[model samples]
Target: MNYNSPHKGMTLIVKTITRITVGLILLYGIYITLHGHVSPGGGFAGGVIIALSFIHLMLAFGKEEALRRLPKPLVSLFESLGAILFFTIAILGFVGGYFFLDWLNKGEPFKLFSAGSILLSNIAIAIKVSFGLFGIFLVLVLLKFTPKK
Candidate 1:
């Protein structure tokens, strides 16, 4: 209910630096998510990091501002779209005369853009999980404050 706190009005310099840092973290999370299949990170890890960035913003700016920036419906739509895209790519392999095909370009590992299908799937999962969690958080926060008739 009361998402705002007395500590919300923090110093401007700290807030500015934090906002920049969060932006960087979110970008890094996206990079990790997209490159997961070819590297150390993966969907879950990157998704959590992405969610954490938003959570930090929520803590800094309050739930109302965060919700305004990222509405629940948009998050849900993105989550659903990501899942659909991932599934569609997976199913394409079956229709392409192969079952469980990797669909990768078979380039050298550790390259900038290698491990095609796995990379794509990882991206999809990252988007789905991140937005899904955000949506859940929005629901829980709203429900906590929603007035019962």
Candidate 2:
């Protein structure tokens, strides 16, 4: 059977499997990020997982397909936005007379919305880490494969 698609990479089985599992991977990453405070995994861990999903796609479907899903410009944009979001939230903490302070009301312990600023921070960190890691992976991959002058 012809495994080749418009974009080139692994075989049909690999692609099929990747297609089935990538979304689950992404969702798991998100779950980790959201419940970070209540659980062990946090933004950094979740972000790595998220980035891995995209990397998996690249490995299974090739660079063209991966780039099509997350274009370079969008990656750059997300990276910037994540940083901006993190910075903005940090700055907002000044309202409480400190940097990175938990200005928002701390709800009941162990609840989803219990940690206000922390949740936001985790989200920002996740966004930054996910796109940042993906960007780094892209750079390393492209750099290594590029022809020497």
Candidate 3:
């Protein structure tokens, strides 16, 4: 847990477990996001999963390594871009004379390719949620926790 030390964060056993689980966690996040339209899990939930995976990395390896993988600036950019993309899609629905309308072709039901706007919206939301949460975590991590003198 000493950030300055060569052996920074957790024990080797925890680090090894994290390395094994991280990819699975990320993949599960993607799966949840993609299946949002049909299932109960949606953009926000999936995004939380995704963010947790990164946060797990930070917890196991330390902030330095996690930040190296995903810099704050890049995460900020992704968050903003997600918002812009979400808004753009909403605005584009105006073309159909409705807000958040399904202007795009709606493919067959229950299939992966179905639910036109929902899919895109889920993606946008996932991006926003993941990066936004991660950014908050980073900000918290950077705070110097000094006890009262």
Q: Report the Cα RMSD per candidate.
A: 4.3, 2.7, 2.7
TM-score, candidate 3, is 0.93
lDDT of 1 by residue, 78-142 (tens): 99998998888788788557865776576778786787688788888888888888777778767
Q: Is candidate 1 or candidate 3 better by lDDT?
A: 3
Quality of model 2 by C-alpha lDDT: 0.89
Worst 10 residues of 3 by lDDT: 1-10
lDDT of 2 by residue, 1-149 (tens): 23467448988889889989999999999999999999899999999999999999999988877887799889989999999999999999899998888879989989998788888888999999999999998888777565789
All candidates: TM-score = 0.82, 0.90, 0.93
Clashes in model 2: which pairs?
A: none
- Model 2's TM-score against the true structure: 0.90
- Among these predicted structures, which one has the highest lDDT? 3
Candidate 3: tens digits of C-alpha lDDT, residues 1-149: 34345477788788889989999999999999999999889999999999999999999998788888899899999999999999999999999998888888899999988988999999999999999999999999989998999
TM-score of 1: 0.82
